[model samples]
Target: MITVRCFAQIREILGCDTRELLPAHTPQCAADLLKVIAGARTADLPKPLLVAINCEHASLTSPVKDGDEVAFFPPVSGG
Candidate 1:
């Protein structure tokens, strides 16, 4: 199982800080996992968000390995 963490508005929306997913196959990259999660939670999420893997910012295609921690958050705004 891989660990997925949610932060900021994402955490509030999901109502949980973390989640576990069992990928059918080893995800080639972070993008792959995002697709899975997005599809799974489509009903709950309607907007785009940012994702990080292992505390590092990553693109959708970023590779993901077993036991990696993935975090999701909304875009930041500043005045």
Candidate 2:
């Protein structure tokens, strides 16, 4: 299974903080996985969405597999 976590406003938009996807439902890369997770609400998500896989920063092209924890969140701005 792939563990997906949403944060900040994304959580509100998606109506959930966490989601679980079976390996059969997930794609090869993070980008495609995002699409599957976002579904028809892709445009509803914030821009420049950040991603982390297994607690480390990852790119959209990053390879993902079963048992990986994927997190999607908006950029953080702070002084």
Among these predictions, the greatest lDDT belongs to 2
Error of 2 at 56 (Å): 0.5
Count steric clashes of candidate 2. Answer: 0
Query: After superposition on all CA atoms, what RMSD does each candidate show versus the true structure?
Result: 2.9, 2.0
lDDT of 2 by residue, 1-79 (tens): 8998988977888887888988765358887778877888989998888889999999788888999998888997769
Candidate 1, residue 14: how far the Cα is off, in Å? 2.0
Regions of model 2 farther than 4 Å from truth = 25-27
- Give candidate 1 misplaced runs (Cα > 4 Å): 26-28, 35-47, 77-79
Q: On a 0 to 1 TM-score scale, where does candidate 2 land against the true structure?
A: 0.86
Best by TM-score: 2
The candidate 1 region of ten consecutive residues with least summed lDDT is: 37-46
